[model samples]
Target chain A: MDADKHFIVGVFDDEEVLLKGIGKIRGNGVKIHDVYSPFPVHGIDDALSIKRSRLPIAAFMFGMTGTALALLMQIWMLGYDWPMIIGGKNHASLPPFIPVTFELTVLLAALGMVGTFFIASDMKPYKWPRQFDLRSTEDKHVMAIDLAINSGKTKDELRSLLRDSGASEVNEKSFE
Target chain B: MQVASSLREALITGGKTVKDVSHDISRHVENKPTKLWWAAMAISVAVMAYGFYCLCYLLWEGVGVWGLNKTVGWAWDITNFVWWVGIGHAGTLISAILLLFRQRWRMSINRAAEAMTIFAVICAATFPFAHMGRLWLGFYWVFPLPNTWGSLWANFNSPLLWDVFAISTYFTVSLVFWYMGLIPDFAVIRDRAVVQGAKIRAQVYNALSFGWQGGAKTWMRYESVALILAGLSTPLVLSVHTIVSMDFATSVIPGWHTTIFPPYFVAGAIFSGFAMVLTLLLITRKVFKLEDYITIYHIELMNIIIIITGSIVGIAYITELFIAWYSGVEYEGYAFYNRVSGPFAWSYWSMMTCNVISPQLFWVKKIRTSLVATFVLSIVVNIGMWFERFVIIVTSLHRDYIPSSWTMFSPTMYDIGEYLFTFGFFFTAFLLFAKFFPVINMAEVKSIVKVASLEKKENASH
Candidate 1:
């Protein structure tokens, strides 16, 4: 298991350096496990061939749910439950309902997007975390590639590739 | 000097140490006496004291101290309420709206704007609370509160009740959003404090920071929370101003009754909010010597928003005129005509020139970038916006359906005092904000600076 877990991680001080390192790692035919940085590095997802985020789909579903809920709430309140004539206008009027509908739509979409983001990212409070490097949160950019140790030549090849591609540091790690 | 060189070299060599950040921020904090801060604080305190005095008088004498009468029941008090609420909009817009847009320039100005929002809301809240003859029983406005005499249920049909709910929600949400953003930055300061007393205070701050270690997981959650809050706030902000507009539109007042009020009010709120943000940023940037962080690019971006929102408001004005004429109701038609050529025509023209004409200058990059021009324009936009509310309330009320009720209204000395006192309420809160909290989102700004460096490297490689 340990032997199969060998990974080569290349660290850079900037996005350009990270991008160059990514190109070299891909050139050497290594599968990238992840690229971690302080903030989102645009285009890195494409470089690593990661799938597109599913947040928007979730937002749409939630928004539809919100619309349904808003309509149901208004209908129940105005149509059946203790209907009062406001401004001598119809109780089930759509114009008056627009403001509440709009508010609920946004509220649900926002909450849904956040929930999906949390679930997909596997983030929760007070959990023990895997620290790649502390300085990644401060200023450094790191790109990590997972490779099979049994492949024999992968480690040296990755080291050379990263060094040649202007990686500030290259290190190897094994995960259980 | 040697330390500075080494720091510069380290940054260039891709070893940009945390020490550099600590040194730069701390040196600024410790070295300066903040003369402008003292001056501003002194003036704000005086204004606040006067406002408190006015409030006391108003509380003692009753709501009659103001210029409000039978026809114009809502005058300067409600006008100021809407104005302050409108001014509060930009803060959330800067922090939440810009965050969602992935705009980096938002970092420089967001802290001040957020602070401004909170302060402005405090001022806005005062008018409504005091406007109630029995200010102590203000909680009665909220429904579901039981009373001994009777359970006075808030009219769910009334937009005023909606205003109460909307404003309260906006205030609570903004406070939470602003405080959440401040936490990590406060931790940064906590980690660097050298003084013993400062260390104790830092510990308190660190605790309040919810033990943020800036770990990957923490960043993910923080970002998620911020994004969610921003998303929530976008519509929430719009709803707030819309509800405020409804306070007028739901009424039978010919000039105030229009479907256009919601969007018109929201656009005007954003326009005025951005203008106020610009006004605050101009002074803060100069006084704090934050020229590099709050670059010309940030000013230009704010100007662009000002221009866009200003144009939206201008269109609303034209639409209102067109609708008034098109509707063909005599009272409505006369209301629009009176606004253009009535006794309060000067106020209406001021609103048009200040809100519509002044912001048009932003279309020219030269004027947008010029600090002097931006500052003057910001003040003008604020003044014009105040008059917009004034014209809506005063003009429509002064000449209502009953011509017998037609009476010219002007603010008395007490009304003027109350107005001036709101400045006091605003500045007092603002002074405390500047003293206690970081006026800039230091963590966010650090991240932007890092990205800028990375971008520079990317460009260099190309």
Candidate 2:
């Protein structure tokens, strides 16, 4: 059997217990594969030591690109290509171009951030996800420890560790 | 669990657990549609069909069928467009602006509000779409597309063109923000289906959820995406109405050429938007038995917002009058005079009473908290807002500088039918959404209820 496909799953009843349990299990020198919950827990990111997402940076970059492209298109199309004066205002005037520019900037930033999120989170239509416990999408919090990742500990050892950490139930799951 | 402050009332009442939240919300989507839902839907569909027929007839007969004359070129079309667009604003205000402010009360209402936003915007788009008589042939002409006609491009300078970009961007962003929030909620329904052995339900929701796994990392990224999207949408919502107001403000017409139009229009939009939200939510909470989730406190808070925005709109009306007088431009002065005492004075007065005066009655606690009062006032505010747009468009355009060209604007059956068309479409789409989707944000509500449940336990021990 592939050890990497095997996981020691712990079902949690309360987020408070699950949070403290995360620190305790980590301190015991057992690495956790991941935690899953129906709703976002308040401090799970800090407990997991997950880095802050850099999505806003991506949004800003996409916004700047939108701004530049809108300006360039307006300037080229109106100033050089078509060259018709509207209300005798100067061709490629920046004042009137501001509204569309701001709109496109926001448009690209929003769409680009969502696209990045879909890609980074591996979410898409027709992609079946690896659900460790069905209850994680309902009322329970779930913690999974890969036996391969925690090679220092045996399956029985990790299962008991999960129980001691206040898990309501402990079980083993494997993927083909 | 997060600590709850004793100083504030619980946003959601009725002792509810996390499990209860999921069951209560998802049950609506999982079950077959109720008889009332089907009946409402049937009426909406019938109205929509009649409206669709009217639209087709108008399109075939052309713009002349809508009572447009030399003096009054724009009438019910632009009025309904602006009215629907204004109604659409409350959704983004709740989902994005209130989210940024850390208003936990918004959690219960935002999902339905955002859905209303999308439908209202769709309704709003029909006006401009129908206004372009040759829509099938020249709809793409509005976009900045490169074409064989000498590579001719849309004029970048016009406010009308700016409206094209602003509204499309607004609709697209609102849709994404709303759908992203729906993903986790869809996962909730999918999991319940799995437990109940409902295979088709599970399969459908799983596909709709994009097979969400609810992992720690994915939830973290989801939070980040929500925050940034909210940030993007706040400014976007503001810009949409501002550009729309500019469509009138940039023009040389005396009444429409005020510098205060942007802020004034934005305030009126929020005022009207909140009224529509209250109207819909009051019925929704009643029908769905969601009184605990959407508590009386939510109604009071929404009423307070209405009072504030309504007063702002009132001041804007007075300010426009003041500015029109102080500008000392005779034509501008006459525009205000014509609004008060002209042939269309009844519409102007109806607007004043409905938009400016009616909302002030909410300052009383009794009326503000009363559901019957709220429902009646909500419809009152929408009617008033519709007249607000009508007064702005028709009153300004009907009496031009040249008296010989001045004419009174009247609506043809097609015009009234077209407006009804939007109403039918709005209700039909909204009813379908209410049936098929989770009307409440189950995921967010569950998180908040954890704190509430914990708070209850702590109080019991004490």
Candidate 3:
């Protein structure tokens, strides 16, 4: 809860400027917090040293939940609850379960993933966002650098690094 | 050096400002429809009206208006239901499954296909509801309702009940997926609106958007929600058709009672659905002049899927035949033989040629890229897939058990009327979609432009 944290933002016209700026910023031994662009910039993750997303793991877990729920639901309904012979087939057959199981697996996985996504991303219905620059959605590219540590020379160094790396506009803001 | 120079060249040449992309898409939206669009819309509307009239007739009278009998109870109604449902699958597959795979080509056509999925599912749902004879009691299909006819419970083992659950689930999931994709594009339209009415529409859109600021948090949440939905939908989409397949596979009929039906049905669903997508995209891309966004690369990718799924269906056909022979069940064996060589041999051959042989042409790049060839092939695939269902349901049921009960079924005017009306329902929804929301996912397309920009950036560094 550092109330006096400062953020340095570098705006770029396109991805090339952003990439070049990233290189220079990282080259200056400044720890890059995050880079925001209108769309995904390839190689930005590697350049910014960001780790691979854990969303897939979440999806896998969701899929597993779906699979388990589907199997158990079928087992309970067909095996234990009022089991009746269908088409003279065995009561405990797995083939009939395959279709619903597959469907449920997909259903559970999808619903679980969506739920996790909303929770992780903090998106909810009708929530108004704070501090938005509309052009970012349109076309403008932006790179934000949080200045949590280091002031004075380090601040100047980061700003000059962004400028030298072809940032069209550099702005600094104090966060509450 | 050559790569570097080429990269630099591409960067310079391909650097499209935000204004350019907006201008390109807006140009299409702004321009009034040409003569052809008017002609097409007029024809579609006429057909749609006729369909509505027929539907009204069906609704007023009973489903007895159609050619369905005790033996062929599931005739045109079920066939059209399954057909449209199968057609609905490709849109979700293209949008959700392809999104997971990070296929950039999906950006151009996903919106249209998703729209088609909603419309087609709407079309598909009408039949079962209407055909229920007691269309007013459609709510009884869902659980937790006390049956008016004593203490009878909905049979859990019944595939029909499974179908109710499946179709309703599929419809809900697909609607959410379609609407979620629309939010950003709606925001764009909202921002760009100038006219008073348009501005009001924009305000409504903004309200619907829930004040999306498109911040990192918003994007992150949107992306995650979309991904989750897509992941959920992928199986949901697959299950819908699989459940539809179960309606056949779960039965005791000779040709229908096979374990392979689910996969086969799913494959056929994708095949027909892609065909429908191709058909719509072909017309849309040309009419809307979305050639740049829905590039030949996208078309080629769809073709590849069409080919693969078509082949999977072909293999399923062979497998069905093989399993029938292998099972040594005389009725099943005869069903297979009768399908291939009986009085309905023409239908079987048509299914084989249209579905199996036509898609094989995609193996050659020339055929896959050719619009005419692809369009014809898509039509063929649709016809073939429809026949596949028809052949499976009709041929098997026609001669079941006794030869004396054997009957040849023909579609009356009512059957054709119901069928045409479903098309009307589908086209009307699509027409409304085009008039309102963007035919392309603008945000997703913007993302692709970003990726292309990144590619150019990489080359510049080299």
DockQ of 3: 0.23
Clashing pairs in 1: B47-B424, B48-B424, B51-B421
Clashing pairs counted in every model: 3, 0, 1
- Superior candidate under TM-score, 1 versus 3: 3
Candidates ranked by DockQ = 2, 3, 1
Cα deviation in Å at residue B363, candidate 2? 0.9
At residue B163, what lDDT does model 3 achieve?
81
Give the alpha carbon lDDT tens digit for every residue of A7-125 in model 2: 99999999999999999999999988899999999799999999988888989999998999889988998999999988988987899888889999999999998999988888887
Model 1 ranges off by over 4 Å: A1-86, A89-176, B1-33, B194-197, B454-462
lDDT of 3 by residue, B263-300 (tens): 88898899899999999899887877667677677788
lDDT of 1 by residue, B13-117 (tens): 232343344344434443444677788878988877877788889899999988888877888888898999999999999898888887666877888899999
- Quick one: ranking by TM-score, best first? 2, 3, 1
Output DockQ, candidate 1: 0.11
Report the lDDT of model 1 for residue B272: 96
DockQ category of candidate 1: incorrect
Candidate 3: the clashing residue pairs are A110-B232
Candidate 2 chain B, which ten residues in sequence have the lowest lDDT sum?
B450-459
